[model samples]
Target chain A: MKRYNVGIVGATGLVGRKILEILVERDFPIQNLFLFASSRSHGKVITCGPYSVSVEGLNDDSFKDKHLDFVLFSAGKEASHHYAPLAAEAGAIVVDNSSCWRMDPDVPLVVAEVNPEDAFKHQGIIANPNCSTIQSVLPLKGILDKYGLDRVSYTTYQAVSGAGIKGIEDLKEQKQAHFPHHIHKNILPHIDAFDEDGYTFEEKKMIEETRKILHLPNLKVTATTVRVPIENTHAIAINASLSKPFELNELETVLEAYQGLQIIKPYPTSEMADGQDDVLIGRIRKDPTLPNSVHIWCVADNIRKGAATNTVQIAELFL
Target chain B: MKRYNVGIVGATGLVGRKILEILVERDFPIQNLFLFASSRSHGKVITCGPYSVSVEGLNDDSFKDKHLDFVLFSAGKEASHHYAPLAAEAGAIVVDNSSCWRMDPDVPLVVAEVNPEDAFKHQGIIANPNCSTIQSVLPLKGILDKYGLDRVSYTTYQAVSGAGIKGIEDLKEQKQAHFPHHIHKNILPHIDAFDEDGYTFEEKKMIEETRKILHLPNLKVTATTVRVPIENTHAIAINASLSKPFELNELETVLEAYQGLQIIKPYPTSEMADGQDDVLIGRIRKDPTLPNSVHIWCVADNIRKGAATNTVQIAELFL
Candidate 1:
């Protein structure tokens, strides 16, 4: 078996740490592991398999000495925007876990299960879709394939973990550090910054990245992204209008058969998807008002399937 | 002003307590207040207006000599089923907050602001719509009145208080006493019992009660009700398709002018609605995919506007 040297940018962050754990759990063939983060996390020691790697602060020349096969970036968009290109230019394929490169025409926004072929189309940078969008599109992809999707509307119950470490702390400490309001026992209907059209940036990502990943540029999509007080996992209520009619059982079968998905009978809650890799789907039913529309409840570990595990899966496609 | 004798059944429960607070807050014209509860709560003292009242256990002869003008029932359906009619027969008009009388053909389900006229048409018992339904209809009524509503879809972020005292305890103690699953730091997509068609009883209540309250019996409506870890407020994402196109500002004006509705611009979250009587409306935007359709975010204190305040408002109609 061939081994490769790999680098994880933003190693001390939530998604970055999960990437390290997943890489070890999946036993990715790595001859050398490099960890990089902001200066605040410099010298922090993180263990990966038999290697004890210290987090190094990223500089313009950080990736120059590392003969990296893959570099997973979970740093914020600013860090990715600054250093991801530098790492990519230094001869490594960058799998970015930020919104910076997602809509870039040259960058491939890849969900490993839904669009691995798109991963191969990457021009040195592969962008992972937003956590909520990642879980949503898996079920949507199956429906779009069999029934043909005309329109989709989403109402998300997103966990604090999606906002990163401070988000989790905000819920734990009952503080409003990362959110606009106290999220301990409240629900924030706003996720990312608002766009001029009243849609948040997070909603826009779900709308645009979903269209781009499905290769359906004009598929109609709208989203209401909300932050709930949960610690992990996000539950999205997806209402989609299909171009073709489908029986409830037929629709269930298609989703169950889809790769990287699970059907939890009756209903799926956030607890069911906590720490799970597969997107947990349940509450499948017809939207009686529309001719061929259905409502689906989807849940998944946002940090895993939504970020870390997805980026790792994308990197595994090359193996 | 003529003061009237008022009787309250289930005088110790969550909504029952809120009703007490609202009555005192509103300074309703009350001559004498009577409190009744199950045998477990018998002999408990409750202060109402200028009198200290003791809760009496309900029996066949409970209301025989009271000459009660109005009775509000917030007890469970079984208790309301047996006690409400007895009170009504004793010359008292009963306003029931249970599901038992909501769908009864003879009973009129009412949201105080939206359909006060129906309150007078009640023969003896008037029904209070479900907490979620009460808040949703206030805005939907505005839309239906201005631009005919063709279809409506709802995704609810409901608080634990909607489940009454036990539901609140479950979240505080990290237990699942009332809900089927753990709700602390979690989201449960299932609320109430599931029907054969996969809709929970709570979802059905939202769908049925909404149509009834709006007097649009043939209106197409669907709902997905989920329980979040919040303590007080319920927020709903309402997507409606209208029969006619609407300018954004025009729709805002219509909703703003609607009684009992408040437009909280940018966003209306659970915190914004907590402890408030008005239904807070926000995040109004066009659903770009569908013509003549828009999205609305609705939030309110489920215990207040959703239950207690609404029932009290109905009582005020007779005053």
Candidate 2:
């Protein structure tokens, strides 16, 4: 097997750690692997397969002379904005897991199953879609392939971890910071900051990312993003209005055939996706009043398929 | 002040307890008060204001000769089905909080804020609509009265208390049963058992109860109900297509004018309705794609505004 020097940025973060664990579990060929975190996490040691590497403090010199094949960035947007370019300019293919460059005309925003080929066309950087957006659009791509979507409305029950480690701790300790309310026994309709149009930044990202990934620049979509107390997975209740008429059986058949989409019966619950890699799609039915429309319930592990697994899948496109 | 003899069944359950608290808090005139519960909770004592009452064991004979002026039944369907009729036959006006009598033609499913007049036409029995339905319809009545409904759909983020005390305890202790999955950190799409048509019993109840409460017998409606881990209160994301195009300003004006609906802006959160008597409505915006359509987010104390508050209000209609 061929080998490559791979680097993981923001490695002490939740999604970052998952990336390390998954790379070992999936046996990705690696000759030399590097893990980078903020100065606060510098002394930590993380192990992957047979390799044990001490986390290094990420700064201007971290990627200066290291000839790396791929670097997966999971830090927040600011850190990625500051450091991702350095790794990319240093001749390393950077796969960023933030919203910073996702909408940049040149950065290819990819969900592996839906747009694997797009990852290969990336110019130095490839962006991963938002956690909720990734789970929703993964199954939606199959439907989109069959019939162009006319309008989509999403009500997302996103897990706490989608906000990263502090989000997980907040739920554990009954604290609130990035979220507007106590999330332990509550749900926050506000995710990200509110845009002037009353849509949260999180909602905006899902709407725009879905349109971009499906190659439907003109698709009408609106989303209400909410933060639920769940720790690992995110779920969405989606109503999609399709441009063409679709039979109930045809909707089921397309989802069943779609790679990385699991259509479970009696509906899909968030717990069912806690550690699962495939996005669970179920509760598939037709909207009573809308012609050519269907409703779907979807769930996936926010850290795995929504982030880590997808980041790794994008890296696999090169091999 | 006029007073009446009142008997409350299922006194130890969640909604039943809330009913007792509200009656005392609001100082509803009571000539005499009686508390009844199942055999297991029969001997328990509960306090209301300055009154202490022992729970009487409920049986076939409990309401046979009580001659009560009013009876509030919050027991499960079986108990309500067996005892509510007996109470009504004994000359007590029965206000049932179960699904048993909600769809009965002669029985009025009343939300005081929406249809207080309908309570008077009840043939000795009145029904409180499902907690989810009551909150949704309260604000919707303002719109329905102005412009007839074309089509409606609801996606609910219901708290565990909607499932009763055991459901609340399940989330509190991280236990699972009744709910398909663990409820501590997850969302269950299956609220009630499923019917052959794939809709949960809870979902069907919301659809039917809304039509009955709104007096829109032929209303086009559908619902997807999910259980979140919150301890109290339920939130809904509603999308309604109106019969005619509505000015956003006029829609807001009607909601503002509604008796028990609070039109809060930037969307309503579950925490906002934890102990509130009114249903908090917000996220009022025009649906970008559908003509004559709007999206509104609503939250209410499921135990209070949804059940106990409405049940007591029905009793007050006669007082």
Candidate 3:
């Protein structure tokens, strides 16, 4: 194996830390690992496998002269916008876990299992879709290829951690919240800023990104993104109107075949997906309400399959 | 004002406690209030408007000797089945918050704001629909009447209290759970046992009870019932296809005019409805994915409006 120099931007953050941990777990071919975060996390030491890398602040000089094999961006869109392209321009391929470059025509959105081919189409930078959408699309890919789909509607029960570390802490304490409501014992229907159409930005991502990844430009997608008080794992109740109908056994077979997917009977709960990288799908049933439509339930640990694991898998393709 | 004798069965339980609190809050016309519970809760003193009533154990003679004007039953199915009929036979009209009588042909399923007239048509016992159904129907009634709904689907975020005090304590204490999975920081899609059709009994109740309450006997209704980690309020994301397309403003106006329904713009969250009697509706928008369909977000305090308040309001109708 050829060891390559790797960098994890925003290393002190939640998703960033997960990416580091996963990189170590997978024993990636890394000659030297670099950790970058906002100035506040400077000098913070994070241990990854045999390497103890001290987090450094990202600046104009950080990506200027350094040549790296790959860099994973888990910072917010603002930071990703500022530094991801810099790393990509500076001889390193960037796998961004932000909404910054997701919809950009030049940046290919890649889900390792679902659309690995799209990774090759990337112009130095690849986008990882929203956690909710990533878990949802993995199971839908094989079925979408054979059965085809007309309309898909998602009602997401997202965890507080999807907002990142601050959100996780908000639930642990009672005083403040990253969410509008007190999230300890409540739910917030708003995920992101509301658009004029009344659909949220988070919802729009699930709709648009699902279509882009599936290579279905004309797919009709709608979503309601809600934040539940759970600490991890986002659950979605999906209703998809198919273009064709097949045996129930066939649908189960397709979903169960996903490498990181589990088809548990009765229904998938958030707890079952915690700390696991696999996306769990259950409560599979034919939607009697709509012709050619089915009700599917899917759950995934927002940090693992939704974020860190996906970026690491995308990087593995390069090795 | 007519002061009538009121009896609250299962007074020590979650919903029963809420019923007691609400009866005092609303200052209902109660000449005498009698409390009844299981053997374990007997001798507990509950203070009301002007009297402290000690809850007594239910026995064969509990309902046989008393000439009660009205009885509200929140005890389990078996208890309600045993004692409700006895109270009804002894000349008291019963409003039962149990599934045992909900689907009975003689029992009219009532949501006070939606179907007060159905309360009058009761053959001895009026059934309070499931907590989820009760909150959902309050907002749909006016819209269903004017627009004529085709298919309505509910995805519920039910609170722990929906399962009674044990479920609430399970979340609070981090101890034993009524659910198979830990209820704290998790979600359970299985609410009640699964029927042969793969739908949960809670989902079935929303489907059947909504159809019955709206008097749209053949209305297409489907539901995905999930128990979220919230302590109060069952929030639902409802998609209803209208038989006729009307102005969105007119739809909002009708929903806002419903007596106990409040149409909060942007979206209604679970925290906003806690301890309140009104069913909060928001996030009202047209769903382009489902033709002639509108997306609705509604939240109501499951113990208050979903159970106790609805039962109390039903009693107010007879007052």
Candidate 4:
């Protein structure tokens, strides 16, 4: 195995931290590691493989003249827009965990298991799909490959952590003060920033990314994205109307035998899917309204499969 | 105002308790009050209108002798199946909160604000739609009526209370133990029992009830229902594609002028909808894939609009 030099941009954020944890847990071959953060975190130290490395402040100079094998970018869109290209220009293949370049014509949106082959065609940068989209389509890919999909109608119960560390802190602070309002006990209707068009940024990603990744620009995709108080996993209730009729047994066979998709046979409960790495799928049945439509319940650790795990998996494919 | 004699079935459950509180708070004009429960709660006392009444054990004879004006059935389906007919046959109009009568051809599914007139023509019983369905459609009723609905794809983040008192207690117990699994921090895939067909009953209700209430037997409706750790509200992400092309302004106008739907237009966060009584609608926009499609985020206190509040409002129609 050839060990590679790696760096994580936005090292202090939620997804960045999880990527570090996963790299160590999965024991990926790492010859050298670097951590980058904003100016405020410049001198902080983080543990990586028996050594404590000081976090370097991010700037265009941070990537100047450095020969890096891979750079995992988990910062917000603005930072990625300003920094990802600099790192890529320095000969590092940037795997961005942001929406900055996802829909760009030149950038390839890759879900390792679903489209690892697409990585070889990346134009210096590869983009990870939205957390909700990543977890949602993982289970559907194999099924969709076998039976053509005409439309998808999905509702998401997304965790706050998908918005990063601040989101988690907001819910925690709200919970502790008994803030006269029940924060954790209620489901929030909003997730990310609301656009002038009224859909949150999160909902828009589901609409746009699903089409691009599936290579079906004309496929009907609609989403309602919401932020609930949960801190870890994101779950989706999918009512997929198919172009071809599929037997329940055939659908289960397709899901069960598929790689990267875990079928929780009887019915997938959130408690059962919590902390699991693979996309947990259950409650497969035919939709009565349409002749070939089917309904499925999907759950995945949003921080893992939705972000970190997918990034690491992409890195693995590069190796 | 004409005061109607009213009785409550399954008066010890969570929704049943909420109904009692709302009725008292609203000062509904009740000519007489009767509370019925199972044998386990027969001796319990519940106060109604400055009077303390003992709960009588439910039996065939419970409604056989009383000339009741109206009865609100909040018991489970089995109880409703056995007792709802008995009450109706005895000449007492029944507003059933259980799923038993919801899909019956003779019963009319009513959402007071959406289809209050449907209650007047009830053959014997008026059925309340599922909590998830009630909240999702209240905002869309006027829009769908004006523009016409082509299809609906909905996913629900339902509260544990929708499962009754035991479900709420289960999550509370799980949370107190600080069990490796934090109930509040996780999402559970299962909301109700899996039937032989593999679809949870809650998912089925979302599909069936929407069709019946909208009178769109052929309308494409797909639902994924999950039970979250929250105690009160149920939130849904609804992606509705309309039959006709309508602008965002027209949709907003329909929502703003619609009865029972409250538009939480700016930053419609869950924090805003908690403890509120009306169905909160926000995050409305056009679906990029289909020109006529629209996406919406809706939230409502499940124990209120989903159950108790709706039941009490039904009684108000008679008063």
Q: Stretches of candidate 1 above 4 Å error?
A: none
| Backbone clashes in model 4, listed as residue pairs | A188-B270, A189-B270, A269-B189, A270-B187, A270-B188, A270-B189
Clashing pairs in 2: none
Q: What is the TM-score of chain A alone in each candidate?
A: 0.99, 0.97, 0.98, 0.95
Q: Which candidate model has the greater TM-score, 3 or 4?
A: 3
Tens digits of lDDT, candidate 3, B78-124:
99888898899888999999999998989999888787888888879
Give each prediction's DockQ, rounded to 2 decimals: 0.87, 0.68, 0.79, 0.54
Per-model TM-score versus the true fold: 0.99, 0.96, 0.98, 0.89
lDDT for each residue of candidate 4 in B1-319, tens digit (9 for 90 to 100): 8776778999988888778778888898877888898989998998755757788899998987678888889998999999999999988889899989999988988898888887888877888888899988787687778989878877777777777776677677765342223456577656566678776787778877888888888787867676677776777878787879888887888888887787775535554655566888877777765548777878888888888888888767876
Question: Candidate 2: where are CA atoms >4 Å away?
Answer: B247-250
Worst lDDT run of 10 residues, candidate 3 chain A, spans: A174-183
Which candidate ranks first by TM-score, i.e. highest? 1
What is the C-alpha lDDT profile of model 4 across A214-276, one tens digit per residue?
888788886777667777688887778777878888888888887878887765556565566
Per-candidate Cα RMSD to the true structure, in Å, reads: 1.0, 1.8, 1.4, 3.6
- Considering only chain B, report the TM-score of each candidate against the true chain B: 0.98, 0.97, 0.97, 0.93
Candidates by DockQ, descending order? 1, 3, 2, 4
Error of 4 at B4 (Å): 3.6
Q: Over the stretch A1-319, how does candidate 3's per-residue lDDT look in tens digits?
A: 6899899998988999999999989999899889999899899999867989898888867876667989999999999898888898898999999999999989999999999999998788999999999999987886787788889999999998899999989988864658887788778888889998888999999999999999998898989999888889999999988888777888888888878889988877787899999999888888888888888899999899999999999999989
The model with the greater lDDT, 1 or 2, is 1
Tens-digit lDDT string for candidate 1 (A150-233): 999999999999999999999999988889989997888899899998999999999999999999999999999999999999
